[model samples]
Target: MLSVMVVAATLFSVTTVMDSVETSIEKGTARLGADIMVVPAEAEAQAKTALLAGEPSTFYMDRSIEDKVRKVKGVKAVASQVFLKTAQYKCCSVGNMLLIGFDPKHDFTIMPWLSKELTRPLGTDEIIMGRGLTAYNVGSKIKFYGKYFEVVGMLEETGMKFIDNSVFMPYAAMKKLAEESKHKKGVKAANLPIDKISTVLVQVEPEISPQRVAIFIEHDIPGVKAIVSEQVISSVRKQLFVLLRSILSISIILWIMALLLIGVVFSMIVNERQREIGLLRAMGAKKSNIFRLIMTEASILSIMGGIVGIVLGGAFLYAFKGFIRSSLNIPYLWPSAAEYAVLVAGCLLLSFLTGAVAALWPAIRSMRMEPYEAIRRGE
Candidate 1:
């Protein structure tokens, strides 16, 4: 029983970590797919490759493309965004950061899905800081590029590498910031057009295939590249699936070894108690009574091990949730009661099967013991 408990705890911990990692990757991929990404024709290769490699990259495209993309067949809506590369500040400043500009009312990805967590909605002079934006939150005013904006919302931790380190604000504010920076350095608008956008997100009509639509946009829209949800998430999904399969394989091997070891141990115990069994049989202790004793012992061991395993697993998850979330780069939520219950039941069932299998050899051997000879040998 003690051995079973130790093995069960180890197996459960391994499985729990495996599940958390896979689930985190899956959620991250889903969140990354909120919209189809559009990039500049010239930087298409760079942008796509960067995204696939899980690195950050930006491209330049005309803001006017928004109107054109919005009208494309199968395109439901379009929003433009620009990302500024990180820069070192003269003094202590927000670390490696990204400045994203979007139209709040029109940007479905940020305004609809993410802003609900805020006390107030996003606006032109308001910004929504990502999880990585430090020393800023709702009601805080931040200045960038000489343009000031109030932090009206804050994003919950979504384990994406880029989002955790970026800040999101309105396109108007970003443009204003650019103008201010240019004026400070005496640069002219003619040299730098504020109408440039780094990328765009297009929402596809429900009836249209995203892949087909992406192809159409790529062909029809010159100087632009289109990528739908599948293109971005497929690679991540494959990586996660591979990891999950490997972990499950390990768990199965551990479980089998545990069952076999348990069987061997119990077999030895039954052999040592042969004379006791023989005496009981001679005294008319029914075969069923002998069977019950073996079964009860197995059940006790299995149940105790299974329960301890589950509790330890839960504690591990609770203790290192933040670390896991950061490492995997996905939103975190406490395991729902339903999920936890399923884990407990599944573990219990596996344990019970282990106990039952381990008891089989002992059961058969004890049933065949010769009463007189077994007792005489013991004497």
Candidate 2:
């Protein structure tokens, strides 16, 4: 039973975490609606951090890159965004939060879905906020770098921190805010350059491969890096799995030890039960019956232990979901119903097999014993 519990717990916990990470990546990239993200060569890490964790970041690239990328073969559209960070101010709802300024015309991704939340066209004084900024409502006002902007819309949750905690506005509004921020007393001036863009989201034609387009973009442009959206997700998944492998190794060792312990325990129990088995044998119980009884008992305990471990492991993950996301700085989403079912089935099966295998030798040995001699040995 203990052996089964350890195996079940390890499988459940690991599967839940991996599923959440995978779900988050799929949802995040889909909502982003871009095949490629182009940024300054040096800001690659910073861009990933902001995109994954919703951490406030400030980075810029030449605005002219937007035109350069549009000229790339198979490029369908290009939208530029400016990234900004705020200084600590009493009026700011969230300190040092990310603020994004995007071109409304060329944006095919984030704003289209978010626009549904707006009753009218977004005004220059209005902003769209990510769901993580829960303290504010649609009509609420937020001050950034001493410039106040009204929250006009709220984005649906994307699991990606960048989308959840960010604020979005038109490119013109950010420029206006930057202009006003220069005169604000005791505040860090917005480090936005009128001629600079932070990131360029690119959508390519259907016939072109995103990876191929990304390579071309990088080759045609210097001082910039074009990252494939899928590549970013895969890189993060690989890095995290490498770390998880060590934990999985520990779980594997525990499983082996549990199996050995269960075998030893059942062996002791079988030795002590020789007298009982011998009497049953003398009473005409078949060897098959004795073997079946032992296997059945082991199977019952294994199933029960597996269930308890799964429940406990799932509850632990649910209780600490936030802590896991924050500590890892990664997006997470719970497994779908179908996914949970498959995982549960797999864990239970493994547990059952482990217990049954451990008890096999003990049951076989019991069946081979002669009745009177077995009773004498038990004495």
Candidate 3:
């Protein structure tokens, strides 16, 4: 019973983490708010890496591509964004933050959500922060490239580290910063790369196929690669599935070993208690009562073992969540209280069933034993 509970708890924890991470990633991808992303052909891998790592990175292409993308057939809307990599210790309270520039007039990605949080459009010198940014809050001021900006709003958690850890500002503000940086002393102003954009976001018309639009953008646009949001997410899902399969395979093997060990242990226990069981039968206890007695003992042991296992497993998961996420390179969100309650109940129920099943044959054999013959054999 103890072995079974231990293996079951470990399996449960692994599956729960994997499921939570996969779900969070899917939800975060959906909230990205773009059907397709267009970036310089040389920057595709770096862009994906930045997205996954939630780190500041700079990659740029000609800003003119935005106009070409907007003119493409089936294009409903096109927004251009610039990525600025902040210095580790200069012009910012926090180090190595990613600064994103969005066009308020043309953006569909952040504006719709930003509108709900703020009553007015973002000012040129004001910024909205992602939830994962801990250093600044509403009304707090942050410096970027020697320029100061106030945090006007903060976005809700999106579970994607890239969006959650980034800071968003108006494109005009970023442009002004870039212009000022050229003359500013002691700053890496040359990194700004004026007249270039980091990426272009496209929203396809309702009747147009996103995949087709992505292909069109790739062919029509020079020096750029077009990525369909669904395809990118599907690729990520496939990678996660591979990890899940490996975990599941190991868990199955452990579970089978646990079950076999538990069965053997229970059989020995029943054999050792034969005299006591035979005595009970001789004293007017029915066969059903003997069976129930043995089953009840198994249930109690299973329940105790399960409780211990759950405590150990839950503690381990809670204590090492951050470490686990970093080590595994996966995003994870803890289950809500109600969801955890369900998981706990499931573990207990599975442990109980395993105990009952493993003890079934032994219990039946005990019940069918002749009292005198069993007592004699025991002596």
Give the winner by TM-score.
3
10 residues in a row with least lDDT, candidate 1: 184-193
Tens digits of per-residue lDDT for model 2, 1-379 = 8777877898789877877788888888887888899999999988888878777788888899999999998799998999887767664556788888999888776676673555466788899988777898788988887767898888877788888888999889989888887887876677788799999999999999999999899999999988888998998899888877777788778778877877787788889999998999999999998898888888888888889889888888888887987777788767778989888888888778877888888888888889998889898
Model 3 has an lDDT value of 0.80
**For residues 219-310, what per-residue lDDT tens digits would candidate 3 score against the true structure?**
89888988787786678778877887787788778767766777788788878888887788789899999899989988888777778888
Q: Candidate 1 lDDT, tens digit per residue, 1-379? A: 6555655665665556555544544554454434578888788666654444334566677888878788778888887778765344421134235677777667766654363455455566777876655677678877554446787777764445455456787777667666666665432221224678887788888898888778878887897878775665566556655765676677677777878888888888787888898899899987778777777788778878878876776777678877766565433334456766666677777777788778877877777777887687667
**Regions more than 4 Å wrong, model 2:** 112-120, 137-140, 145-153, 179-191, 278-288, 311-323, 333-345, 367-379
Error of 1 at 311 (Å): 5.7
Residue pairs whose backbone atoms clash in candidate 1: 159-329, 159-330
| TM-score (C-alpha, index-matched) for candidate 2 | 0.83
Clash pairs, candidate 3, are: none
lDDT winner = 2
Pitting candidate 1 against candidate 3, the one with the higher TM-score is 3
lDDT of model 2 at position 268: 87
- Deviation in Å, model 2, residue 153 alpha carbon: 4.2
TM-score list, all predictions: 0.78, 0.83, 0.86
Model 2 deviation from native, Cα RMSD in Å = 3.4
